[model samples]
Target: MKWLKKSVLLIAVFAVGVVSGSMIWTSSANNTGLVDPNRPGSVNDPLITKSYVDQAVAGQVKTELEKQLQGQLEQLDKMLADKQKEMDDKIVQFQKQLDALISKAGGMTVVELQPNQTMYADPGATFIVRNGTTIAVSTDANGIPDVTGGKDLMDGTPIELNHMLIFPREGRGIKSTHSSTVFVMVTGGYTVMNPDGTIAASSSMDNSDQNETAE
Candidate 1:
C-alpha cells in the first residue's frame, strides 16, 4: 500500500510540473517577441489594426464603385445611341415629307405678257388670268376648258379675271388682248412668245396638272 501511494504522488507531481512548464514556456515565448507582427492572421498574432481593415474595405469599395460606374457608362452610351438613331429617323421622315410637299406644289410660276404677247402651253397646263384682258387661242372649235364656269371657252373669248382655266390638249394657248400688260399664273408647261413669235421665256413641267376638275 505504501509503494502504491508513492507512485500515485509521483504521477501527481509529474502532471503539475508539465502544466507549469507549458505555461512558463508560453509566457517566455510571448515576452521574447515570438509572435510575428508581419503575420496578423496567425493564431499567435491575431490582432488586426484599424488602418489595415480600413485599407481592405476601401479597396473593395473602390472595386465595386468602378464596376458600377462602368455599367452606368455602358448604359448611358446605349441610351445615347438609341436617341441618336431615333432623331436621325425623324429627320429622314421630315425630309421626305418636305420633298413630297414641294413636288405636289405643281411648280407654279407667274408670267407677265405685254400687249399682243401670246402664251402657248402643253397638255394639262393650268392658267389663272389675273390682270388685263386675255383671249383664248385654239386650232379647232374646242377651246380652253373653263373649270370654274364648267364649259369650253371659245377662241377669242375674253378670260375672266381670277378664273382658273385648263388646256386639255397641246397647241392651245392664250394671248394678251389688252393695251396694258397682262399678269397670269401658269402651272405645268408653257412658252411665252412676243408679237413676232419669238420665244421670250419658256418652262416645262414633268407632271400633269392635278387640279383639272370643274367646281
Candidate 2:
C-alpha cells in the first residue's frame, strides 16, 4: 500500500511541472521573433512593415510639392512686376512726345508770343490776338533766350516752357532768331533756313509742291 501512494504523488508532481513550463513558454511568445506568421497581429500586421514606410514617403513627397509650388508663385510675382514697369515706361514716353508736339507751335513774323501764353503748334505759330496783333515773344529781361515766352503768351505757365517749333500759315518756324539754332526748310525753290536763315538740307524736287523742311 505504501508503494502505491508514492507512485501517485510522483505523477501529480510531474503534472504540475508540465503546467508551469507551458505558462512560461506562453509569456515569452509575445516577442517579435516568437510571432506566428499564420496569425495576424492585434495592433499591426507583423509580417509587413510597408505601411509605415509608405506613410513616411507620403509626408516627404507632400513637403517637396509645397516647396515647388512656392517657388513657382515667387517667379510669377517677379514677372508681373517686370511687365508693369515696362508698361509704365511706355506711358511716360508717350506723354513726353505729346508735350513736345504741343510746344512746337509757331506764329507769324509780324506777331509775337507774349509772356504767360498757352502755346500750341500750328501751320504758323499763331496765338490769341491782342488789339488785332499777337503778343510779342521776347527774350528774357537780361537777354537770355525766352523759349517759354511763346507758351506764356498763349496762356501757359512759364514753368512748362520747353518747346522747339512754331507753326505758320505756310511753314513751321523756330521760336526765335536770337539763338544760333537753324531750321532748314525746303521752300518754293530750294531748302530754306527757318530761324537763322540758311540752306542746310536738300531733297529731290518732284510734282509735290508742298513745302518740305528738314531739321
**By TM-score, who's the top model here?**
1
| Top candidate, metric lDDT | 1
How would you encode candidate 2's per-residue C-alpha lDDT over 1-215 as one tens digit per residue?
99999999999999999999998787778654585645776555555589888999999999999999999999999999999999977975674454345435431221222222222233333222212112223332221122435332222122222332333333322232222221222122222233344333322333243234332
What's the TM-score of each model vs. the native?
Answer: 0.45, 0.30
Clashing pairs in 1: none
lDDT of 2: 0.42
Each candidate's root-mean-square deviation in Å? 17.6, 13.3
TM-score, candidate number 1: 0.45
Model 2 misplaced regions, further than 4 Å: 1-18, 24-62, 105-215
lDDT of all the models against the reference?
0.80, 0.42
For every model shown, the clashing-pair count is 0, 27
